[model samples]
Target: MTTKVFTIQPNKRLRAVEEIMKWAHVRHVPVVDERGRLVGIVSHRDLMGAAISTLQVRISEVERLQHNAAVEVRQLMHFPTATIGPDERVQRAAHLMRSLKIGCLPVLEDQHLVGIVTEADLLHIVEELPDASLALRI
Candidate 1:
């Protein structure tokens, strides 16, 4: 899990979100409210999906500009997000993510965003397991 999580405001433009994602090298960003509560989540897949849907209509500069200008984080985010408590077991978090078919989960405490756990994190954990070397031996 990464404690140093990057977040975004709901009102920010989709173009700004794309820039942030690129610069920060993060695929998922949690959306926070004024009180710093996790409200929603946006993923790189969401942006690409939206763009693809629009392009399927007609690929035009004017249409692209309109799409970029009109879209906001609030409109693109996945709402009622599934989250995990920071104290929860990694296995539990992993299970939830698998069942939900989500790539990541925002870690929260008292409804405030604290961290984020992704499939990458789980992969790291698996690699560090005590018996990880056994697979190579066999």
Candidate 2:
């Protein structure tokens, strides 16, 4: 889980979200309300979907920027997001992500957004195990 999670507001432009994701080198970002409560989540996949849904195959870069600028985070974020508690075992997080077909799970504590657990994080755990090869085998 990443404690230094980057978050965005619902009303922010998708362009800003893309900028943050690119600059931070992160694929997922949590959305928060005015009081910092978790509201939604947006992933790189979501950004691509939004762009593809609105743009033509041969659109120019400028047109892409305009489309992203016109859309808000709320328009693309996944709401009522599946979340995991900090105290839960990593296996639970992994199971939820796999069963739900999500790339990440927001970590919540007392209903507050605390961190996030992503597939990469789980892979890191697997890599660190003494018998990592055995775990990876089908």
Candidate 3:
């Protein structure tokens, strides 16, 4: 779980998201509302999909990028997002992610965004755990 999270407003431009993602080196960004509540979430996949959809026959790559920047974060984010509590177990989060086919989940506390847990974070935790081995009885 990453305690330091980067969030974006629903009205912010895509370019802002891209810049933050690039600077923070994060793939998933949570979208917050005016009250700092988790309203939606955006991933690199979502941005890529938006970018691909904007490709036109006569449009140049630069134009497509600019067009994407004009689009608001709310337009590209996935709403009604699934969130987890800070006290929830890691296994539960992992199961949710696997079943939902999501890369990460925002952690909320009392309806407020707190942290984020990603697949990579889970993998890292597993890697740090004690090794397991089988013992055979003859």
Tell me how many clashing residue pairs each candidate has: 0, 0, 0
**Model 2 poorest 10 in a row by lDDT:** 51-60
Using TM-score as the measure, name the better of candidate 2 and candidate 3. 2
What TM-score goes with each of the models?
A: 0.85, 0.91, 0.87
RMSD of each: 2.7, 2.0, 3.6
Tell me how far the alpha carbon of residue 87 in candidate 2 is from the true structure, in angstroms, after superposition: 0.6
- lDDT (Cα) of model 2: 0.90
Clashing residue pairs for model 3: none
Q: What digit string (tens of lDDT, one per residue) describes model 3 on residues 19-96? A: 888999999999999899998998999888776453345777798788867999999999734789999999999999
Model 1: lDDT equals 0.86
Global lDDT for candidate 3? 0.87
lDDT of 1 at 133: 56
Question: What's the alpha carbon RMSD for model 1?
Answer: 2.7
Position 29, candidate 3: lDDT: 92
